[model samples]
Target: MEDHANSRHKKTVQPVAKARQEVYVLRDLKEYLGESLLIIFSVLLALVLTEFINKQHEKSQTKELLNNIKEELKKNKQAEQEQYVYQQGILKRIDSVLRDPGLQKKVLTDGTFHLDYLAPEGVSLHDLSRVAWQVAQSHDITPKLEFKLVEMLTDIYDQQARIDKIEDKEAAVFLNYESRKPENIRETLILMRDNYHGWAFDRAPALIKKYDAAIKEIDRDL
Candidate 1:
């Protein structure tokens, strides 16, 4: 009878010990899982914060580029305005010569024809600046700007390039030229920026209109 009682006690105690062991193992697993999740959450938060900071920095740099371009445009506009007036003066003088028969005959017949016109200056060019725009493009900041704004910038620069080409076409005539011949002088005078449609002059109303429109758009954006 004692032996049977001892066997029953042993069976009850063994089950109780096994149950406690299982509970302890489950608690350890929960603790491990909690730590892993916390670590993952922390790493994700850091990555998100780093990305946000980088975006902000890039946005600020793009803005600075636009403002620099705006200032540059303002200077170029002024330079073009002055160039237009000077070139118009030369064109009007040439027109006066064109209407005069005596002057035309003298220009046709005379070399060394003692021109009464004093200090016939060479072709006047617009000092337009593309530095700021070039820098922005090189840095790839233009993609961040509004699409319409980029188009406007391209148009203005293209117009500037056209004007430069006109000036360059006639540059050979006046580059260190020392001829006092009346025929040559008259030809030079004729080609010295007849009008915006011709070469070297920016007096065309259309060109100024474009500049004004660009300035207005930039102002609105700012």
Candidate 2:
């Protein structure tokens, strides 16, 4: 009877010991799962933070580019206005010459015509600023710019190019006239005056209006 009691006690204690071992194993598994979850969460958090930082940096860069472009456009508009004034003055001179037959006779006979009155030496063809546009293009910032802003810039530059070309042609005519004989000078002056009037009066003002609208839009956006 003593031996049998001892054996029964041993069996109960063995089952208890096995249950404790299983509990320890379950606790270890829980700890390992928690550690894995924490690692995953940390990596995800890091990736999200990096992405947000990159986006903020890009936005700042884009805004800076837009501001620079706005400044450039302002300068261009001022230049255009000055050019308009210069051209208008030339047109007035041409009108005075055309209206006075006496002045025409004197110019034809003396060959003492002033080409400066036709094309001012100080005024350049499209004296507009392009540094900002050039930098933006070189740095691939156009893609980041708003679609409408890009379109407006393109239009303004296209008009500038056209104006420059016309000015170049006028300059060429003046240079050719300068080297011509006195008898041929009158006709050349007439041609130069007509060309100047056409571009200055008709085309330039339209381009200036476009510039005004575009600048206003840029200001609003900024």
RMSD of each: 9.9, 9.9
How many residue pairs of model 2 clash at the backbone? 0
For residues 68-92, write the lDDT of model 2, one tens digit per residue.
8888888888888887787777767
Each model's lDDT:
0.67, 0.71
| Clashing residue pairs found in predicted model 1 | none
Best model per TM-score: 2
**Distance from true location, Cα of 32 in model 1, Å:** 3.4
Candidate 1 segments whose C-alpha is farther than 4 A from its true place:
1-27, 101-121, 173-196, 200-204
Put down candidate 1 lDDT per residue, 1-222, tens digits, no spaces.
999988878844453455434344446877999999999999999999999999998878877887888888888888878777766776676677667757655544434433334114545445678999999899897668777888888988888777766556655544425434544665655654343346446434556677778777777666
Error of 2 at 208 (Å): 2.3
